[model samples]
Target chain A: MVLHIMADALFISVAILTIGSAIVALETRELVYGAIGLAISMMGIAGFFLLLDSPFVAMFQITVYVGAVAVLVIFTVMLVRTQALFSIKEDPRRKTAGIVLLLVFIGGIGAVVLASGLGNPAFTKFNKPAIDVATIGKQMVTYYAPVLVLLGLTLAASVIGALALARREDIEQKNERVD
Target chain B: MATVPEEFRFGNFLASIIWVILIVIVLLTLVILPLTFIVLFYVPLPPVNGEVLTPYLFLTMIVDPTRTLPIVKYLIHTTPFKVIVFPGFVFAAIIAAATIFVERKFLAKMQLRVGPLYAGVWGVGEGILQLAADGLKVISKEILIPSGADKPIFWAAPIAFVATAAAVVALIPVAPGWVVSNTDVGLIAVFAILGFFPLIALLFSWASNSKYPFIGGLRALHQMIAFEIPFILSALSVVILAGSLNLTHIATSQHPFWFILFLPISAFVFFISSLAELERVPFDLPEAESEIVAGWLTETSGMIYGLIQLGSYLKVYALAALFVILFLGGWSGPQIFPHQLGPPDAIPLVKVLTLQGLYNAVTVNAIFWFLVKTIVIIMLMLLPRGISPRIRIDILLHTGWYKLIVLAFVNMFVALALIYAGVLGPGGSLSIH
Candidate 1:
């Protein structure tokens, strides 16, 4: 009983932290701070994954999102013009549109949750053991192999495309030198 | 401004000490005792020796020396004990401290100099106490923050670094069942924890708001991120060989032969990538002292710097231990430890003194071997600092992205070939289980 209460409290706290950081990310003026806030929010999401008893997913969330993506965002933010980091020119129209979009998102999420029966006690209760990494790996190989391969190919292609885009200026400079 | 203060007085010092002691005693009696009593009243106590242990019984056990063994045994098995004492913070910290001293002495010898000669007992150990002295000095020194620095992150980054390092340490198994947090995906969890270091570095440098630190932070980001792929890929080969992600299981899987025998290229790649991840020697561009003024750590002073060093050395210990666990057949050695320390019918007092209940010969042997292998690996890691200069950033990135990844992939194929050839893995020719 005590453990359950503690778990609930932990869940509530993690939810608060995630939401608060996400808000901070959106609201903060400094781009670097926003990036850090985003990282923290992702960490909170990882914590949620931990609460859901999917530590593998939690670790992956941290590794990919907080570790790589957020760091990349921060790096780019830091490299930009210092003056631009703190400046956000607010418009009334944009703010109204943002609020409308947010409300629509929240409503859509709420509708999905209601329709999916996630609110039901039976649906929420997890009696089965969490899936192990080995089982997941096996499933990936046997069942989801094509999807996995496609995902890998997409990621690889994107990486190559990004490299090409980044190196275009260098290539042009080299051509000029040759001329 | 240069005015001299009054001379020190022994009487005044004594009086001040007495006053402080009196205040502490008063606080203990008035505030702390009641708080403890109130807290203990509501808290559930565990049974000791099949008896419910109340506050009175706890006090009695404290007073009666004979009844203390059970309590000690119980305490040893507690989560706090595992996390704080064995296989956790204290253990890792001690290893980190030792590594620091050893690195200093080892590097000094390599550079043809005597290191830390004034700290040990009459120079008998030649500087064994240097770490203690350094710790004291750093703790006593003032922490300096730059004027426009982000105060919160500047203060928090060092602590976060250490905490992250400790989290990684908690996942590592010193001996069988000796890990603090024994997760199923321990390898992935380690990689996850390691991913935070670069973030911490960048944040700290940004907080510092200095040119050099900014450059250093970017280098750290690039270096750590570039090497991460190779690090994961190299470990993936080990994972493929072991067919389990749990570090303990991986270690135990190598009972018949170490993974290095089969995946030498993976081991080599792992070592190099770990060096890059750790930012040691040939990969210490982030903290290249001559070029970048301590890199991301430019603004850190006193205990802040100390904490970062401690974190990095803890990282060094962790990665070296990981390498040992992955490739060197962790804790598998000749049975040097006896089945029992003394006669089985020895006196209870002798048994208690030797901690017979807690001490297993097998565990002791495992720990000894693990430590020995980890130390050797650590020494190997330190050796590069003495011989090689730090590489350029572009070269470091290129090596991490191109060479190490290719090497790791080559070994992954080799691991696959072995698995298919029935040389290892389930029901294979050389499989132990």
Candidate 2:
């Protein structure tokens, strides 16, 4: 009983943190603060993953999001110093469009929920088996093997493309110098 | 001390303090006291000795001589004790600080100079106090900020770096069942925490809002990301051999033969990648002083610089410990601890030293071998700091991306070969278990 209550408390607190930080990310004035807020929000989601007992996915999320994506965002924001980004003038057209889009998203979700009737108050006890990485690996190879190969190939192709593009830039610069 | 001008009389200040105290007293009595009582009523108290204990009972237990055994056992097994003392921040910090002093002395020997002189210990010139002295110097120095620097990030990044390093330390098992969080995926969690270092470096450099910092940050990003593949790949070879991601399992799997004998290439790859990851010499291009004025860390000074360097050394210790855990048998050695320190029944609570005492004996033995291996690895890590100059960026990237990755792959194949040949596996012909 104590464990259940503690888990519930932890879950609620983590959910609040995720929403609060995400709101801060959107509403903050400073770009760097926004980026920090985003990182915090991502971490809160990782905490949620931990609560869900998917530690591997949680670690992967942290490694990719808080470690790489946030840094990439910071780098881009630092490098690109465009004056237009400093002063975001509100347009009536854009404001109306945003509100309409938000309403549509909300209405669609509400409609789907009402149609499906997912509000039955039945609770099922969670008794998950202890699943380890080997199980996940075996399933990935047997069931999703083609999808795994597809991802690998796509990543390899993109890497080759990026390298070629970089090489081309170097050659073009050299050609310009010679001319 | 600077005197405050007596624009207003001291009597007025004294009267204001009295009013504040009066308000606080009223607030505590009217609001806070009832709230505390309500909370105490709602919360369930844990039972002890067939009695629901209160604060009064706890106080008496503190003075009780016979209660020491249970108290000692609880303290030893507690999370805070493990995290703060053994195999955690304080332990890692002491090792890191010692590394700094010993590294200075070692490099000094290599260069024929007096290193960390005058900061001697009792009857020894080991620079035992040098790290503390340097810490004081850094703390006392002024912190300077660039004009357009992102102040919040500039301050937070170094702290985050240290926290992440400490998080990695928390996962390392110094002995069996002796970790802060004994998660099954401890090894992967270490890699995940380690991934934060590059982000911290980049963020701090970007936060500096200076040209040199920007260049340095980019180099750090490239350097860290490039080496990560080889790092994971090399670790993959070990995972294949052990068939487990738990650091403890990996260690125990190596009882029959250390993984290095069968997977030397992976160990080499792991070592090189770790050196790169730790940003040690010959791979310290991100912070090369000659070309980039200490690279991404150019703008850091005072305590900020101190924190980053401390974090770096902690990482050094962590990686060295990991190397020991993976390639060398972690905490495994011939049992050298005496069967009993004295007559087991001498102690009242422990007739024959008790379960706790026996566990402690084993733990001490494990810690001894673990430290021996870790220190040797640390010395090896520090060797290149004196021997080699930092390499160029192109060569560093090429080696990280191409050579190390290929070597790691080759070892992965070798691991697969061993497993299939039934030479060593979970229940193979020559299984370690």
lDDT of 2: 0.87
DockQ scores of the candidates: 0.82, 0.56
* Range of the 10 consecutive residues with the lowest summed lDDT in candidate 2 chain A: A117-126
Candidate 2 docking quality: incorrect, acceptable, medium or high? medium
> For residues B210-323, could you state the per-residue lDDT of candidate 2 as single tens digits?
888879889989999999999999999999999898999899889878999999999999999999998889898888888989898999999999999899999999999999
Residue A122 error, candidate 1, Å: 3.0
Candidate 2 Cα misplacement greater than 4 A, ranges: A27-30, A86-88, A110-123, A163-179, B1-67, B121-123, B347-359
Best candidate per TM-score, number? 1
The digit string of per-residue lDDT tens for model 1 on A17-126 reads 99999999988877778898999999999999999889999999999998899988988887788685456777999999999999999999999989998888988777
Which ten residues in a row are the worst by lDDT in model 2 chain B? B350-359
Candidate 1 wrongly placed segments (more than 4 Å): A82-97, A169-179, B1-42
Top lDDT model: 1
